[model samples]
Target: MASIRAEDLRIEFPLYHFARSMKKRLLGVASRRVKEDPQNRVVISALSDLNFTIESGERVALVGHNGAGKTTLLRTLAGIYEPVGGRLTVDGEIGCLIDPAAGMDGLSTGRDNIRLRGLYRGLDAAQIAALEADAGEFSGLGEFLDVPIHGYSAGMSIRLAFAVATAFQPQILLMDEWFSAGDADFMAKAQTRLEQLVKASEILVIATHDMDVVKRWCNRVIRLEAGRIVGDEVV
Candidate 1:
């Protein structure tokens, strides 16, 4: 039952700023404004008329240049962003690795973060407790889990985050880019786990600029430009 469908999907961001001067008002007046108001607010379209359908067991790669809305689209699919127009339907449990520290607290200990992230993912206290030990061991943080994440290095932080993020396999996996963290050995381990997750998940959507990874891991490639899908090809 895992599937995703977008029909003429559109996402826009409204930039709001106070009208400071007559010049600014005039400039805003000349430009596209939200609701045609005198206020200095302009809406920038992130995704326009995007249409696609992804069924179960598809590994899809979103390939695009910077500012091409790949991350925005992924966020939309992850239910983090609401569309401004059109329709989007996503059916399944979604796990996203959009940013390594997205739902983590640096002021808290790694163990605390594991609990918090599990809660965010809708796991109950008992479920979170059960996963805590395995997540801790998988992160390779050992006693460092008791220390505040602020004291951890970038690699250490990502290791813990990745471990927590992947502890529960999701039906739909969304990744913004390839994860690169930890030492050489740790990265190798992480990569193996990532590949396993991608394979086991019902659907995988990854946004990355690396063509080799797209070719190797994805069954389909979606090329985006200026908030629109320009090409879609089966690998």
Candidate 2:
């Protein structure tokens, strides 16, 4: 079963003060006059005292204003970021795209990225071979799949990333505002593919500012403000 639970999970990015200086925030050294007293640890609390449950087969939409920990929450679910306090539990295989280009090497060809991404996702040689075939279907990279991703245009790169990310069948899916960025024709096809993929997944947690998407795709909605959940409601 694919399930996710966050028990009072807290995520903080520890920002250490190298030197007590106003300009210490940037990499460049700051003059002593502007420096603040060096502190051991300074933490920016991204998500504080967060608790939520996403059961298998649940479709959830996370809504929030900017800087409200929506992206941070998704990262924790994808196991990309560890919580500072509390624990997060996720069951079954998980495939997520916090950033669409996370796994694809820019210098590698689209075809190479497809195989590489599959391998990175824990797929074996045979399994990657199978997904390689599907890669051509999901992505319209055309002959560019054989060329280095660096040579592709922005749209081309995004297409390749989407193809590679969706090749793996995951019990839990995490997406961050990536499903509808292309042209209308591509959007239609991609939406159809997303619907296809969503049908098979046990759970999906999406973070986006688009309320229409939340209304259409998510059965439940979570609203966050200032890194805290303000409301959890069923739509």
Candidate 3:
């Protein structure tokens, strides 16, 4: 079954510009959120002492103010970032919608990126063909699919990326937020696709500021502050 567990999980980003002496001075004045690691590098703790478990069949929302580490936690769960301390365990296939352009190459054609993604995922030729078809149809990119991604508009890129990312079913779905940059028709279609994926997936972890969305789609809420989980409750 799909599940996620965080045991005192911590994620930190080092500040490369700080000199050793400056880092020491900053560390001395820093709150718990900033510190010098064992290697004496100055780092900002993006997630601190996070402990939570999400079992299969759960829809969890990560809510917090800006810079509260919502996206950081989502990236960590997506394996885009590694924790500097503690442990995080995720069981099952993970699909991430944290960044629309993630895993996509700006210089490559949309079709090329789609094929590369399929190959990277170990999909067979038939599966890759299906993925390409799905992305082509759902993205509405048509002739533009053969065009380099850099030539597409922001909305076009988002549409293509969303289509490709959601083409395959996943055991765990991690979404930062629903894309609003798409036009009305595309947004409606994307919503439908998201609902279908949420229903099919064993676990859904979304970081969103829309409480209305959380109430409508999620069963649980996890509130964070300064990278620390302050509240965890079932709705």
- Ranked by TM-score, the better of candidates 1 and 3 is 3
Alpha carbon lDDT at 99, candidate 2: 86
| lDDT ranking, high to low | 3, 1, 2
Cα lDDT, all candidates: 0.86, 0.79, 0.90
Q: Supply the global lDDT for candidate 2.
A: 0.79
Query: What does candidate 1 score in Cα RMSD to the true structure?
Result: 2.9
Better of 1 and 3 by lDDT: 3
At residue 130, give the lDDT of candidate 2: 88
Q: How does model 2 score by TM-score?
A: 0.88
TM-score of each: 0.90, 0.88, 0.93
> Per-residue lDDT of 1-235 in model 1, one digit per residue for the tens?
7999999998887665645474355555643322232343556678889999999999999998998999999999989899978999999989888886877888999999999988887888889998898799999999999999999998898899889878888999999884865799888988898889899999999999888889889999999988889999899
Candidate ranking (TM-score, best to worst): 3, 1, 2
Pick by TM-score: which candidate is best? 3
Cα RMSDs, all models: 2.9, 4.8, 1.7
- How high is the lDDT of residue 149 in model 3? 97
lDDT accuracy of residue 222 in candidate 3: 97
